[model samples]
Target: MRASDRAYATLLDEIQSGSLPPGAVLAEVEQASRLGVSRTPLREALGRLGADGLVVQQSPRVTVVADIDAGDIRELFELRRALEETAARLAAVRGDAAAFADLAGEFAAVTLGDADGLDTYYALIARFDAALDAAVANDYLIAALRTVRTHLVRVRRLARDNPQRLAASVAEHRLIASAIGARDADLAAHATHVHLHNALESVLASLGGGTTTGGAITTQGAA
Candidate 1:
């Protein structure tokens, strides 16, 4: 990978993992040296991040990670609902029934026990997402979903493991997959909506009721 891509990937991972929490300042010189990259490449990486809405420029020489809150989460879910429900409906119409049936079986078999277990569950979800994308076969729709997923990684970090939520999510995904396999467009869309609603509520509750734009923004000094 190019130096800038390397930097961007590293920084993106850090940001999503909460190592570089919301509002964290990413000084050009400091990050460049830390990542062993020169200023030019670091700047390029920051520019890309800014474009992704993961960071924002405060002034000529200042930038910081963007803030996220309950309001932002709600907006994100709104978009998610539209995209995912459409994807599910399309998948129900165009997807391979046998493939989706297999996926539903996998979801039924998932058991989130430890960290490794949760990782496995997430990997399964990724597979489901990939299948949905492939089934839809619409470049524009897939692109929009990708953008939503980028922010979703960071949003997911706000919530810890709730066994009940995880279990419910598994059942919801299973139902969605089964509905698609059955070619039930209406059921697939409704299942996706219910899953998102429950997910949003769970994430907000995890944030001690809800988050705001209050503490997620910080300004850095311009050089």
Candidate 2:
């Protein structure tokens, strides 16, 4: 990989993992030296991160990780609901039913009793996402979903300690996958909506009620 790509990947991982938390200063000279890269490539990486909304230039020379709060999380979920619900509907019409059936089965079997199991469950989710993208076969939609998922990784880390939420998520995903497998586009979309609703609630609760805005969609029987 190029130096800039390497730097971006490292910094992105650190930021998402909270190793470099919000508001952490990223001095170009210091960062260049730490990553064994020159200022030019580091700047390029920072520019890409800025485009991704992960970093912000405080002045002409100083940069820092962007802050994420309740508002940002709420706005993110709003977009997530739109994109994922649409994706589920499209996948139900265009995707391979057998594949989604297998995924549903996998989701049913998922166990999160330990760290390894959690990792496995997330990996399975990744596979499901890949399948959705392939089934939808829409470049523009997939691109948007990718952007939502970028920030979603960080948001997910916030709710990692909630075992009940994770278990609920597994069942929710199974319903969605099963609906898609059955070629029930309406049900798939509805399931996606319900899952996102519950997910947003769980995440906001994990934030200790930090996102108190009523902008989130109100749903009945979440989870």
Candidate 3:
């Protein structure tokens, strides 16, 4: 991989995993040395991260990880609802029913009692997302959804402590896949709406009754 690509992937993973939390300073010289890259590639990586809204440049030489609060989560969910609901409806009409049926069966058998099980469950969700993207067959919509999902990784990490919510999400995904497999567009869309609603509520509650912009949760700094 290109040095810029490598740096971007490492930084993106750190950001999503909370190894580099919000408002973390990212000094180019320090980060470049730590990542074994020169300043040029590190700057390129930071530029891409800024474009992704995962980082913000406070000055020509200062960049910090972006802050995410309850309001940001709400706004993200709003876009997620629009895109995912529409995707479900379209997939119901145009997707491969058998594939969704298989996914639904996998969701039904999901067991998240262990770390490995959780990994499997998340992999299944990834497959479901891939199937949704393929079934929709709209590049524009898929691109927009991809952007939403990028920030969603950070939000989702906040909710990982709640096994109850994760279990509920499994059931919700099953219903969505089942509805699409049955070719019921209305039901599929409605199910997606419900799932997103529940997910947003869970994430907000996990944030200690919803943090605000003025008083956001703070974590460790990143490179």
Candidate 4:
């Protein structure tokens, strides 16, 4: 990769992994020198991130990462419920055999799932979910999925670490896959929503008194 691309990726990875945290300021000149890239390409990379809502640049003043809190997570999930349901429904209706195969491929991966530790299951799901997003064939729906995908990344790890949740999640996706395979729009949407709803409740309970960020395990929400 080019120097600027490398710098951009490194910075983005740091931010997403929570190392850089949020609202961290970055300057073009400093980062270019640090990443061993010229200002022009670094600026281009930053511009891309800015469009992705990962960065905010204000002229010559400063650039900083956008930060979202627990409240933001709640909002993000709410949007996910709406947008993802619509996407699932569309996938069920419009998804061809190729889409079914794609969903099935992801469904197969869950059988190898490990509940004890973090795995790339979440990333795999993202790819599966992306298929549905594309199947929606609607720009608005696709755009929303692109936006919400980032916020869901962290919560996905915590949620999947729960043993019961891992199995339940697999079952949920299977149902979604089945519905889509059957070409039943309503069923697909309903299955997806039910899965997400169950997850929200389980996760809220797992999180206890804290936000979805979950500082500790506790008994709360619903059983």
Candidate 5:
């Protein structure tokens, strides 16, 4: 990969993983040296992240990770609902039945008993997302979903420790996958809608009295 791509990937991972938490300052010279890249590529990477809305410029020379609160979470879910529901409906009609069926099986077997299981579950979600994107075969829709997913990684950490929400999410994904595999577009869309509703409610509640400053985010929304 090019140096800028390398820097972008590393920074993206750090931001998503909360290693570089919201409001964390990213000094150009320090970050460039830390990532072992020159200023030019580091600037390029930061520019990409800024475009993604993962970071923001406070002034000409200062940047910091962006913040997420109740409002941002709500907006994110709104877009997620529209994109994912459409994708599910289209995938139900045009996707490979066997692929969704296989994913359904994987979802059914998912275990979230420990950290390792959590990692496995998230990885499974990534696979399912890739399959959905490929199956839809719509470049425009995929692009929108990709942008939503970039912020989703950060939102997800809020619910990472919520066992009940995680368990429910697994079941929800299984149903959506099963509906798609069965070639039932209506069911797939309805399932996606229901899942998103539940997810938004859970996430808002996790926001604790709908306040961003309350405890660690308590609910995990869909991927």
Candidate 6:
């Protein structure tokens, strides 16, 4: 990565890892010093972050990171579920053979209980999602899914705490990949909904009654 890109990636990593947090005001000088980069490159980094919806820009001030709330997380997940269900259905019908091949490999890696495969699993998920999104071929659905992904990233960290849930998620990913490979739109949509529903349950369980920001957690197996 270029110097500016490196700095930008570093900041984004910190943000996603919960080190910077939502609503935290970051001083450019401190960030530049911390990242061992010049202020100019740091500024460039922040600009890109802003564009990615990871940061917010305002008049007469440096950009600020967006604040996350339970409502925001909940709504984002809801949108993701809706959009992805549609995308999976379309991808199944369209039969993008190359993308399906890639997704199959990712699904295999995710099903394996190896430590190093986790990152690869997530990367495969991103690629799978992008491919599905492309197959959907609706600009509005594509745009909405992008917004939902930004906030859903926050809750994703919580998902790591539950091994069983993660394994289940991988299984669900495999189902969608396989179903899409078979050109089964109905099955793809159903599998996508089922997986996302379980994920929502897991996330809600993790945040249950912790704070007002995490929202409602069902003790009665709501899923």
Task: Choose 2 or 4, whichever is better by TM-score.
Answer: 2
TM-score top scorer: 2
TM-score, cand. 3:
0.92
For all candidates, what are the clash counts?
Answer: 0, 0, 0, 0, 0, 0
Per residue, candidate 6 scores C-alpha lDDT tens digits across 85-126 of 888887888768667866876786664467676777788788
TM-score of each: 0.92, 0.93, 0.92, 0.73, 0.90, 0.73
Q: After superposition, how far is residue 223 of candidate 3 from its true place, in Å?
A: 24
Candidate 2 per-residue C-alpha lDDT over 158-217 given as tens digits, one digit per residue, 9 for 90 to 100: 554688988999999999999999999999999998888778877877775432334444
- Pairs with steric clashes in candidate 4: none
Model 5 ranges with Cα > 4 A deviation:
211-223
Per-candidate local distance difference test: 0.89, 0.90, 0.90, 0.70, 0.88, 0.75
Q: Candidate 1's residue-wise lDDT over 1-223, tens digit each?
A: 9999999999999989899888888999999999999999999999999988899887787889888877777788889989999999999999998899999999998979765888889999999999999999999999999999999999899677799999999999999999999999999999998898888777877766743333241122211
Error of 1 at 8 (Å): 0.7
lDDT of 2 at 65: 96
Off by over 4 Å in 4: 1-4, 56-60, 97-109, 112-120, 154-160, 201-223
Q: How many backbone clashes can be found in candidate 3?
A: 0
Better candidate by lDDT, 1 or 6 = 1
Candidate order by TM-score, highest to lowest? 2, 3, 1, 5, 6, 4
The residue pairs found clashing in candidate 5 are none
Residue-by-residue lDDT tens digits, candidate 5, 11-102: 99999989999899999999999999999999999999999999999899999999887778878987998999999999999999999999
How many clashes in candidate 4? 0
Worst 10 residues of 4 by lDDT: 214-223
Q: Listing every candidate in turn, what is its Cα RMSD in Å to the true structure after a full C-alpha superposition?
A: 5.9, 3.6, 4.9, 5.4, 4.6, 4.9
Error of 1 at 209 (Å): 1.1
Q: Model 5 scores what on Cα lDDT?
A: 0.88
